[model samples]
Target: MTILIGCAHGTRDEQGQETIHRLVEDIRTALPGKEVREAYVDVHGPFVADVVAEVAAEESCSAVVVPLLLAGGYHVYHDIGEAVKDRADVVAAPALGPDPRLIDIVMDRIREAHIPDTATLILAAAGSSDPRSQADTEAAAEMLRARWSGPVRIGYAAGIHPTVDDAVADARANGEDFEVAVASFLLAPGFFQKRLTESGADHVTEPLAPHPRLVEIVLDRYRDAGGS
Candidate 1:
């Protein structure tokens, strides 16, 4: 049987871990009778290598690993890719990002934050050092700009230039009426989400996870991967 492995960039936050597990549970619930398991790429246990090895050992047990990340970078092209590379039974799915539906969620969260049209919108992502991740984020920001008429800017939480605080500060400095609001590009809450709240933006939206649409995205990735 082929199992669904929901692999995420793990977090040290206890609640973050719980939220991730809950998301995985929801994924399992969505695809009833399918065995969905959880693993991490960093910060916590059940690492991808071990998980894939375990599944590969079971006779005829194939698996699909769906990345819980919103963007592709080192984790996607290297870490997770390396874990499943030599194993034919393990087919790794694409990252969950650069999707229109995710932009929908960001807009939803922005509206939920109650920011007006005149305000400056900031697309805040937990950044990566990889240039590819930056390109991916820029593409996402372009998608967001397509929907919002006001100025949109990209900010990072870590490992990249223009931190969230700097972005928020710049937006605030634009003019007297500048109302800076941030649309979180993160999948789930953790250290970076907390940083966003402290970034001094007038308003900040919640993370993308704990939403039904994300579960749909994960399943879509899994199905798209096709069983081995």
Candidate 2:
């Protein structure tokens, strides 16, 4: 059987850790006989390189690394890419965002916050210097805009201009009478989510993990990379 390695950018937050762990467990449950494991690209281990190396050494087993990240960035292109580059038995899948189903989860979060119809929505993401990552985030914002009636904007928690605070501030200045709501485009609760909450928006939506749809997305990505 092929192995599915769910690799996430590790977090220091305990709840964040639990959320990611639960996500991996759900993936395992979804694919009963397949071997599923967890690895990280940053902040903690088992790091992606080590995990891939170990899996590649095993007999009769190929591995697919599915990034739990919302978008492809430095970690995906450099870290995960480097880990699997030399190994014929290992391949890496795309990051999880820019998917319509994820937008569905974001919309649900916005509704749960009871955001007003007049509220301006800001899609908040953990930014990256990589142009590909920025493009992925923009695609996600466009997806959200298609379903949302209100105006949609993009903001970052770090790494690029127009921070969440700046986005919230601009929304308030341009549409003073309208409420500003931030829809977190993050995967789990952690530093980035906290930044969104503190970005001065009238409301902030929750992160988009610990959901069944996410598990489905992971499975699809694994299959797309030729994993069994």
Q: Report RMSD for candidate 2.
A: 0.8
- How big is the positional error of residue 174 in model 2, measured in Å on the Cα after superposition? 1.3
Model 2, residue 70: displacement in angstroms? Answer: 0.9
The lowest-lDDT stretch of 10 consecutive residues in candidate 2 is 171-180
**Candidate 2 wrong stretches, greater than 4 Å:** none
Clash counts for the predictions, in order: 0, 0
lDDT of 1 by residue, 87-149 (tens): 989989999988888999998898888889888888999999988888888989999999998
Best by TM-score: 2
